[model samples]
Target: MNFASAWNAQGPLARQRREAMLARVGQLRALEQRAAERSAEARAVFEKRGQLLPRERVGLLLDPGTPYLPLCTLAGYLQDAREPDASVPGGGVVAGIGFVRGVRCMVVASDSGIDAGAIQPMGLEKILRVQEIALQNRLPFLHLVESAGANLMRYRVEGFVQGGALFRNLARLSAAGIPVITVQHGSGTAGGAYMPGLSDVVIMVRGRSRAFLAGPPLLKAATGEVATEEELGGAEMHTAMSGLGEYLAEDDRHALGIAREVVGRLGRAPTPALPQGGRVTASLPPPPGEGWGGGAPQREDLLTLMPANLREPVDMREVMVRLVDDGILEFKPLYGAATLCAQGRIGGHAVGFVSNNGPIDVPGANKATHFIQWMCQLGHPIVYLQNTTGYMVGRESEQGGMIKHGSKMIQAVTNATVPQLTIQCGASFGAGNYGMCGRGYAPRFLFSWPSARTAVMGGEQAARTMQIVTEAAHGRKGQRPDPVQAKAQFDKIVQVFESQADAFYTSGLLLDDGVIDPRDTRAVLAFCLDTIAEGEAAQPRPMQFGVARM
Candidate 1:
C-alpha cells in the first residue's frame, strides 16, 4: 500500500463540523428509540389482552447474546400524512437476520404497538427487501405475524398490486426448500391472513392468533354472515380443524418457545453457515490503538478532511487515506484523475475502491467501468465513495462520446456480479448517484455519512433553473415577470431542496439504510463485506413446488 497522508487536523471549522455531525447522529438515534417506545400504545392495548409488545416478542424469539441486524429502522420517517412531528419510523415491522437456538433465520415482528402495525408503503419495501435477502442467502424465513394489513383509507393501487409479491415470495421460499416459519401473534385478517397459510411451519398463539380471509365486520358487509375471529381462524380452531397451525401455544412465551424448538429441529441451514458468523471466540480483542501501526489516518481526521460547504472542492485522496487500511494501491490514477480507482484493505477485507472528485468526463466513466469489471473478475467487493457533480455536460463532452462512456459506467454498476457497497461521503447528485450505486440501483448495502447531501442537482442550480423557466413562461404570456415575487418563490424552493437533501431527512424516508458516524465507516464496511462473502459460500436446497403445511 502506497502511503502519503495529507489529512492534518487544525482549525475551528473542523471542530464545528464534527460537533454538528455527532449531534445529528444522536438526534436520529433518539428518534429511532422514541419510535420504539411509542409502541407503548400498542403495549397497553396488548396488555389489556394479556400479550407482550412487538419488540418484546422479537427479543423472546431470538437467541440471547447474539447480534441482531435491525434494518431500515427509519422506514416511514417523514412520509406520514398526519403530521411531520407525529410520524413514527420503523415502518410497521422490526426485522433482521439473527439466530434462534443456534439456527440462523430472518425474524420479523409487526410493530402492532403503532396503529395495530398497519403496513406503510416503506414498510412494505423493507419486508420485500428482507425476503429477497433471506432467499438469496438461503436463510430460513421467519415471521412474527401481527398486522392490520394495509390502511384502506390511505391505500395506493401500487401498494395493493405489489403486496401480493410478498406472499408469492413466501411460496417461492418454500419451493426453494427454504423453511418458512410464521407465528401468528395477533390479528392477521384479509390479505394478511396468508402469513400462516403459506408457511411451512406455523405456530399460532392461543386466543391471540387471528387469521381469516375477512374479519367479522368485513364478512358481515360482504356475505351477510357474521363470524367471530376465533370461529373463523384462531389458534385452537386452525390447529384442530383447519390444520393451518402445526402447533398451538398457550400464550406469547409459549409461542416463542415452540418457534425456537422448531428452528432447532431444522438444525443448520442446508448450506451450514450463519448470517452473523458461527465461530465464537472466548473474548473480543481490543480495538487497534495508535501504536497498532496500520499507517492509516486516525478516524477523527475525517472531520478535518470533509468540507462543510458542498461547493468547496476536496481531494478524495485525502478522504480515502482516512478510510483505507495501510493506505491504498492506487489504480489508474493518471488516466482518469477525476475518478480515483484504488485497491485497499479495510478492516482486513480486500476491496477495490471507486470515488469521484469531480464531474465524470469521458475518460473517468470508461476508467470506472473497466475498474468495476476488473474487481468483479478478481472476486473482490467494490466500495464506492460517491461525491460527484455528475457527468460533465456541454457540447465538448457530447462530442467526446460522454453519453456512450457514461452508459458504460452505468452498465457496469448495474450488472457487475459482485458485492457493491456505496458510501455517500458528500455530494451525490444527478447520474453520478446512479452510477455510484444509489438506492435505486440497489447496492448490497448503501450507507451515508452524517455530512452527506443527495439530490438531483444542488439547491442553487435547481433554483436558478426554475427561475429562468418562470421568466420564460411570463414572457410567453406577454406579461412582465414580477422579480420580488419570483425571488421569494426561488428562495423557498432552494430551502426546501437543501433541507430535504440532508442525510437525516433522506435516511428517514428509507432512501439510505441509515446514516453512519464517519469514524465507523471502515468497520461497518468490513462487517457487510464479510456477510456477503459467507452467504456466497453457502449452498441451498431447491424443490419443484412449495412444501404444504401438512
Candidate 2:
C-alpha cells in the first residue's frame, strides 16, 4: 500500500472548514433525534393502554451492549409540502439489525404510539427495503407488530399495490429457511392480521393482541353477526383454538423474553467462519480489530475533506487516505485519473473502493467496470464513494461512446454478486447516481453524508437548461422574454431542484437508508460488510417452500 502524505492534517483552512461542516453534521443528527423522539409525544396514550412505546419494545428486545444499525430514521420529511414541518417519524416503524440471545437478527417493531403505526407511502417503502435486506443477508426476521393498517385517507394505489410484496417477502423468507418471528401487541385486525398469520413463530400478548380478520363493526356490516375481538382471534383463542399463536405471554416484557428464547432455539445456520481479517460484530466472537495501531487520520477530518459545496473539487485520494486502513493500494491510477479504484481495508474487511475525482469519462467508466468485475471474482465487497457530476456529455464524448462505456459500469454495478455499499459524500447527479448504485439500484446498504446532494443534475445546471428553453419558446412565439421575469424564474427553479436534492429531503423520503455523521462512515461500513460476509459464509437449509400453518 502506498503511504498518503499529501493531506496536511493540521492545516488552518482545513480546521476552519472542518468546524463549519461539523456543525452541519450536528444539525442533521439533531433533526434525526427529534424525529425519533416523536414517539414520546404519544406517551400518555401508551401509558393509558398499559403498553410500552415502539422504541421501548425495541430496546428491551435487543441484547444489552450490542450494536444496532437503525435504518430509514426519517422516512417522511417534507414529503407533504403542504405541511413541511409535520413529523413523519420512522416510517411508522423502528427497525434495524440487532442481536438476540447470541443470534444476529433483523429486528423491526411497529411505532404504534404515533398515528397508531399506520404506514404511509414512504412507510410502506421502508418495510419493503427492510425485508429485502433481511432476505439478502440471510438474517432471521423478527418483528413486534401492532399496526392500524394503512392510512386509507392518504392512500395511493401504488403504495397499496406494492404493500402486498411485504407479505410475499415474509413467505419467501420462511421458504428460504430464514425464520420469520412476530409478536402481536394489539390491533392486528383486517389486513394487519396477515403479519402474525404468516410468521413461522407467533407470540401473542394474552389480553392485548386482537388479530381478527374483521372486528365487530365490520362483521355486523358484512354478515349481520355480532362477535367480540376475543371470539374472533384473541391470543388465548389463537393459541388454544385457531393454532395461530405459538406462545402466549403475560405482558410486553414477558413477550420479548419468549421472543429472545425463540431466536436462541430456532436452529442456527452455522458458526460462520470469518475471512482473513475485518471488524467483527459484538454479537459474534470478536476478531482482531482493523486498525494500524496509531497515526490514523481523525474521523472528523472527513467533514473538512468533503466540502458541503457540491461544486468544489477535492482529490478523492485525499478522502480515500482518511477512510481506508493505512491508505489504499492503488490500482491502474494513471490509466483512469478521474476514477480512483484501490484495494483497502475497512474494519479489517478487505474491500475495493471506487471514488469519483470528477465526472466519469469513457475511460473512467470503463476502468470502474473492469474493477467491479475483478472485485466480484475475488468475492470482496465494493464500496462506492459517490462524488461525481455523472457521465461526461457533449458531442465529443458521445462520439467517443460515453453511453456505451457508462452502460458497462452500470451493468457491472447491477449484477455484481458481492455486497455493495454506497456513500454519497458530495454531488451525486445524473448518470453518476445510477453508476454508483443509487437507491433505485439498491446497494446492500446506502447512506449519505449531511453534505451529500442527489438529483438528475446539479441545481445550477438544471436551472440554466430550463432558462434557455423558456427564452427559446418565447422567441419562437415572436415575443421577447422579459429579463427580470426570466431571472426570477431561474432562481425559483433552482430553489425547487436544490430542495429535492438535499440529504435531509432525500433521506426523509427513504431515498437512502439514513444520513450519518461523517465520522461514523468507516465503522458503519465495516459492520455491514462484516454482516454480509458472515451471511455469505453460513450454510442455510432451504426447503422447497415456506412452512405452512397446520
Candidate 3:
C-alpha cells in the first residue's frame, strides 16, 4: 500500500515541534563538541611529537566525501566524571564504520588524549560491541592502537575477568576470515600487546610505537629483568627482529597512509545485489524538497510528523514514508492494526520495518514474529522503530496469552539471522524494549531520538502502583496510613523514574549508540544497511588462528 503523507510542515503545531526538536539536536551536538574539545587539548603535544591526533588519522584513512557513522560518542559520560559538566565522553576511543579506499570497514582509534587512553569500563564494552558488529557483518576491523592499557588503580576484579573477551574477539575475527588490522601508533603494554599480535596485518610507527608484555618498571619488578622499550617491542624490533609487524612507518601520517594502502590491497569485492526484485522498491523519485540520494523518501516533514508529546498518537507509516525510497508493502495490516509490519527500502537497500502505533497486543506480537521470520528467510535487514508503552495488560489481554505471543516476538528478534537495527523514537517501556531488539538484546546498532523516554512504566503509574501496595499493607495491619508520608513517598518514586527516563540521561549511560536528529533517520539507516550488504558480499579465507608473530 502506498503511503500518502497528510503532514503539514508549515502548520502551527508542526512549526512548534520542529523548533523544539531543533533545540534538542543542538544540545546533542554540544555534548559531542565537548568530547572533541577534550581530545583537542592534546593537539599541541601531538604537533610537538610530529604526529597526528587520533581523529585526524581517522580522517586521513577514510575516503574523501564518504559517510562515517561514529559509534558510542556518549560513552563514559557521567559514569567517569565527578560532575555532569566535567564528563568527557567517547569512552577513550573513537570508533565508527566508514569507507577506507572505497571499502567499508570498522575503524577504532584509541583517544589517547584523555588519561593516556586508559580503558574505561564502558570503553571496553564499546570496543567489544563494535567488534561484535564487525564479526557478525563480516566487515574488516581496523584499530589504531596507543594506550596506557587499564588503570590498575581503579580496576575491579569483574572488569579484569570480562576484559579477556576483548583479546578473544580479535582472534575470533581473524579465524572467521575478517581481517584484523592494527596500527601501533604509540603504546600497547601488558595484555594490550596482544592487540597487534593477533592482527592479520600490523603497521607500526618507527620511533613512537611500542607493544610489550611488560613495560620497564613492571618487567624489572616481576622478573628482575630490565630492557629498553625499543629492544623489547619497538617498531624496528617488532617488524624486523620479532616479525610481529608487517610494515614500519616513519610517523603517524605515514602509518595511516600505509594502513589505507593495506585496506586498498585487501581486494574486497563489490556489494552483491539483493535477491527478489530489490530494484522495484527504489523505482519512485523522492518527494519535492526531500534531498537524499537514490530516491529516498522525504525527511523535511519528520519533525512535524512526530508529535512533541509521545502520548499523542501519530501514524508510524508517515514516519516510514520519509525513510524508505518508495511506498511500503504493508504485511497483514488488518490483522494487527496497531503494529505495522512493512517492507521498504532505505538507501536503495531492501529492508523490513516493524513499528508500533500503540502498545503491542497478542495480535501485534504474533504479526511481528511472522514478519521478522519472513524478513530473515529473505535475507533482508530489519529496522525496528520503537515507540510503545509496552504490551497490553488487563484480564482480557492476559487470558489471550500476551506473554506467550510477546515471548515469540522476542525470540524472533533475538535469533533472527539477518541484521536488526533499532531506533527509539518515543516511549520504550518494560518488555517492549526487549521484543524490539533493545540494547540488552544486542541490536546490531541502536539509536535514539531526543524525544525518547525509557522506563519500566510511566512515572505516575509506577507511583500509584506503589501507593496501592503500601495502603494494602497498612490495611492488613489494621492501621491507618499517614497521608503526608504516603504522598511524599509517591512523589519520590515519580521523581526518580522521570529523571532517569530522560533521553539525555539514558544516552549518557551508553544505552543507545547516540541520540540523533529525527530528520537523519533515513541517512543513518542507509549507511548501516549498506555496511551490512558489503559485509554479505565479502569473502575472506578463514584460518585456524590469527597471523602469529612467528
Candidate 4:
C-alpha cells in the first residue's frame, strides 16, 4: 500500500521536530565550515610560495560537475584539543570519493594548512579507513601529498608503529590493480618519503617538492656530510636521477594538470560489458519513483518520525517511506512487530530494509536472521536503520531463547556476502549495535544522524544498575549506603556516559564514517548504492605483490 495517505507532514509535531532538526543541520554545516576556514587562513602563505591550497588542489584534480561526498570531516573534534571551542576537526586531512576524468577515485589530500599536515593520531586512522575503502571497492587511490610528516614533538610510539600501514596500503592498492597516484606539493621528509615511493605514479612540482629521508641538518649530524634539499630529494633530482617520481612539473598547478593527464591515459575499462554475440536481453528494474507510487514521501516528515526522547516509540515505516523510492513490501510484519523487515527500492536499487521499533524480542531476532539470509540469496544489499535499546531482557525473553536467536542475527550480519550499510537513526545501545551491524561489525559504510547516540546502555540505566550494586555491597558490609554520596556518584556516572554517547563525540573518534543530516538520508543512500554498484561490476586484475620502485 502507498504511504501517502498515512503520512502527515504538515502536522504541528512534524513542524516542530523539523525545526529542531534544521538547527542541528545548521550546526553540522558550521563545524565543517570551521575546518574549511581554518585551512583557508593559510591561503596567503600558499600564494606567496606560488602554491595552491589542499582543497584547491583537490578541486582541480576532480572532474567538474560531478558529486563529491566528503567523509569524516568532523573527526578529532574536541578530541585533539583541550577544549571544545579550540578543537579543529578533520584530523588535518581532506578526503572523499569523487570522479577523476570519468573514473571514480578515492581522493585524499593532506591539509598542510593545519599544523603543516602533521599526521594526527586520528588522521592516521582516517587515512587507513579510506585506504581500506579503496581496496574493497577497487577504486584508484589519489593522494595529494604535502606533509611535515608525524609531529616530532607530539610523537607517540603507537602512532609511529601504526604509521607504517600508510605505506603498506599504497603498495596493497597497486597490487590489487587499483592505481596509487601521488602529487607531491611540498615537504615529504623522513617517513613521508615513502608516500610517493610506493605510488604507481608520482607527479612532483620542481621547486616546491621535497622527498628526502633526512633534511640538511640530519644529514650532517648523521654522517658529517652537507647536502642541500635540492641535491638530496628535490623533484628535479628525484625525476632525473633517483627515479622516485614519474613526472615533474614547474609549479603546483602544472603538477595537478599532469596528474589529470596521467589518470586520463590509464586506459581503465568501463563497467562490465554485455556478452559479445549472445542473444541475451537483461531486464532491469524500473527507474526510481516509478513503480509502487509516483513521488517520494515527504522527507520533512523524517524529523517527526524520531521523537526527541529515545524511549518513545516511532513507526519506522514513516521513515521507510521517505527513504525508499516508492513503498515498502514488508515481510513477517505480524510475526515480529518490534522489528521491521521489508523490501524496498532505493534509487531503483532493491535493498532489504531492517529497522527497530523497540527492543528486539526472540521473534524479532529470528525474523531479522531470516530476512538477512533471504536478502543474501537474492544478492540484494541490506540497509539497517538502527534505533534499538537492545534485545528484550527479563524472564519471558530469556525463557524464549533470546540469547540464541540474537546470536543468529549477529551471525547473519557478520557473514553476509553482500554489502551492508547502516544509519544510526536513534539509540544504538548494548548488543543491539552488534546485531544491527554497527561499526564493530564492519558494515561497508556506517553513518549517524545528529540525534543518534551510541553506548553500551543508556546513561540512566547504567547509573541505576551501578547504584543497586553499590547498595548491595554496603548491605553485605553491615553499612547502609549514604543517600547523598550515592546520588552524587550516580549523577557522575550518568554525566560521563551521556557525554561520551553523543554522536559528535563518537564521530570525533571515527566511530562512524561521519554524522549526516536526517534530511539528506535518501540522497546519501542513493550515492552509496551507486558507488557499490559500480565496484561490483568492475573487474580488476590482482597481482601477487604491489608494484615496487626500482
- Candidate topping lDDT: 4
Tens digit of per-residue lDDT, candidate 3, span 1-550: 6667787778898888888787777777777778777887998998998888877788788765556677787777777645868887778888887777777789898988788888889899889888988998888999999999989999798888899899999999999989899999999998789899888899999899999999989989999997898998889999998898999999988998999999888888533432221111111111222222343236667776666678888788888888888779999989988999999988789999999999999999999999999999999989999989999999999999999999999999999998899999988998998988899988888999888899999898899999999999999999888999999999999999988888878876788987777877888888787777777767778888866666
Which digits, one per residue and each the tens of the lDDT, describe model 2 over residues 1-550?
4747576657876776687677776666565556556767888988887888887788788776555677787687777664655655466777787777757789888888778888767777888889999899999999899888878788778877788898999999999889999999988877789899889999999889888888889899999999888999889999899899989998988999999888888777433332222222322112122221232356757767877576677787777777777668877888778888998898788899898989999999999999999999998889999999999999999999999999999999999988899998899999899999898887999999888899998778889999889889998999988999989989998998899999889998888998876776876787788779778876677888887876
Q: How close is candidate 1 to the true structure, as a TM-score?
A: 0.89
Better of 1 and 2 by lDDT: 2
In candidate 1, position 478 carries an lDDT of: 94
Q: Model 1: per-residue lDDT, tens digit, 242-261?
A: 89889999998899899999
Total backbone collisions for each predicted model: 0, 3, 0, 0
> Candidates sorted by TM-score, descending order?
4, 2, 3, 1
TM-score of each: 0.89, 0.92, 0.92, 0.94
Candidate 1: worst 10 consecutive residues by lDDT? 278-287
Which number leads on TM-score?
Answer: 4
- Candidate RMSDs in Å, in order, are 4.5, 4.2, 5.1, 6.2
lDDT of 4 by residue, 1-550 (tens): 3344375778887777777766766777777777878988998999999998888888888765555667887888888756877788899999887777777789999999888899999999999999998888888899999999989899799999989999899889999988999999999999999999899899999899999999998899999999999999999999999999999899988998898888888877532321121110111111111122222346556766676668867778788878988788889989888999989999889999999999999999999999999999999999999999999999999999999999999999999999999999999999999999999999888999888989999999999999999999999999999999999999999999999998888999999988876766877787788788888877788899988886
Model 2 segments more than 4 A misplaced: 1-3, 269-297
Q: In candidate 3, what residue range of length 10 has the lowest lDDT sum?
A: 277-286
Specify the poorest-scoring 10-residue window by lDDT in model 4: 277-286
Q: Provide the overall lDDT of each model, using Cα atoms, as 2-decimal numbers.
A: 0.80, 0.81, 0.84, 0.85
Candidate 4 is scored at a TM of 0.94
